[model samples]
Target: MPTLAHQQIHPHPHNKSAFAKHVILLLSTMMAGVLQASSATDQHYPIDVQSCDRIVTFDHAPKATVSNDVNLTEMMLALKLQDSMVGFTGVSGWKTLDPTLRNGIGELPELSPKYPSKEVLLGADADFYFAGWNYGMRVGGGVTPDTLDPLGIKVYELTESCIHIMDKPKVSMNDLYNDLLNLGRIFNVESRANTLVTGYKKELADFQAHLTPLPSPTKVFVYDSGEEQPFTSGRYGMPTALIEAAGGKNITDDVKKSWTQIGWESVIDRAPDVIIIVNYGDVTAQQKINFLRSNPAFSDIPAVKNNQFTVLEYVEATPGPRNIEAIKHLAKAFRAAL
Candidate 1:
């Protein structure tokens, strides 16, 4: 037997060919792995998402986008999909976000303080728009799904705002979860979405279990806006569901719409035991309270007289992950008021 060094240095002709074949086999195996990884990254294409009457198909995940309002923007950030976002707007309740979320959001570009104009949205060259009813695109604003779809852009509306168009009987947490799962499917993050939904469900169940139900549901009124005529959440809105889930009754439950403006007399006649003021826009919650306290019309109201008021941020009242927290907060307030 020859020494091992001599055999490798002075290999036979046949041995040389065999060594080359082995090298080629190794390279081929490595190439196959690279291809497999590329395929995995390309999976979940041609996904169809149903938004009300429209079935929008996404050939690939949106790379650039314009997201509107705190609700949709926060949802995208919670999914850890900030790279997909190009610009965002509507920062009404952004201060209430967790520090981590706030830091993540701070890195993104703020396209506008409010809803972006169609020109601004188009200028961003975004492929998708995440928004809600009247929060972003408005009728005749020239940025709707009909207008954007023709330009190769897709739009997804918040499910809570689509009850009227989708014929949903009432708002539920399922709507928020469905939207999260749908976005996950669209973005190929089903596992993350499932985990988030599971966590929220567990937390909500725990909150409900510990809640002490009132002898009678507290008659609650949701004050959103409109000083001339009070604008409140109706039976179809997320606020109504939150109120009911928190062991309180929404006085506007009879109104079959989302948010409606009713005369002051209706609110007076209803005589809500507790008032939930929505904090948003130019009108502060303190201003609303002052208005209620100073006005002779509201003097007779039990909530105003007894000072049973709970203030919820505009984002909390919307359909999002925060809704569960809103329920817990309201439930605590209801228990305290009793």
Candidate 2:
């Protein structure tokens, strides 16, 4: 038997070129396989996203854009599409972000502490705008979809905030999941979206399984702000759904509105067992707590009397990926209080 080296050295003269051509073809086939695999890994583009009654087709994943508010910005980061964001605004809630999300957003440019002016947004030449109604961009602010769409900029509204413009209003986990799925589709990250939603569902199921059934739901009141008239989440708000998922009942669930300002007397009458204080803006959760503790009108309330309060960031209270964690935190708090 000839050695491998001897066989190569003593190859038939007529077969030398044929053997070389065969090697070349084999190499080319391997390279083609590698190239095809790489192409398959790339995101699919030209996605059509129908959200909030508007259909916007993304020819490709947006590469330059401005995202407003914590909810939208965080969603983009969670989807790993932060590279598409040219700039963003609304950093007041940045402190409340998940550490990984905070680090990811830390490198991005912040256009403003609040909503950016139309001039700034337009100047950025962003192809897309991820924002909410009053939360990120207000109507008549000169940055609405009607205005931006004409300028070749597409705007996607935060699902929770759509309650303001939609004919009917309600909040559910599906709202957050839909936003994530739609955003994933737009950016061609549907697999990531599915994985994220699956993880959330599993975590929710585990949490629910361990929960001890209560004779009746624990009454919860969500305090956002306002001293004269307290701002609370109603049936149509994300916080309401979160509270329910945590095995607590939103005392204001009967109110058809989203976030509504109600008389303190109304809150006093219901006397929630737990108070979820929204942490955001210049007003700290401590500030809200102090106001509740100082207010004589609230002294008799069960939540105030027992100091059964859970602090949720304004971002968590909104419809987004963080809502699952918010529900988990609330459930733990409710269990501990009971």
Candidate lDDT (C-alpha), each: 0.83, 0.83
Expressed as tens digits, the lDDT of each residue in 1-105 for candidate 2 is 988757764558889998888889989999999998667545465667876777877877777878887777778878888778898887654444446657877
Return the TM-score for candidate 1, rounded to 2 decimals: 0.87
> Can you give the TM-score per candidate against the true fold?
0.87, 0.86
Supply candidate 2's per-residue lDDT for 219.
Answer: 93
Give the Cα error of residue 20 in candidate 2, in Å: 8.6
| Per-residue accuracy of model 1 over 157-260 as CA lDDT, tens digit each | 87877754557757778888988988898777889999999999999999899878799999999998888999999988889989988999999998888878
Judge candidate 1 at residue 259 and give its lDDT: 79
Q: Total clashing residue pairs per candidate?
A: 0, 0
Collision pairs in model 2: none
Winner by TM-score? 1
Best-fitting candidate, scored by lDDT = 1
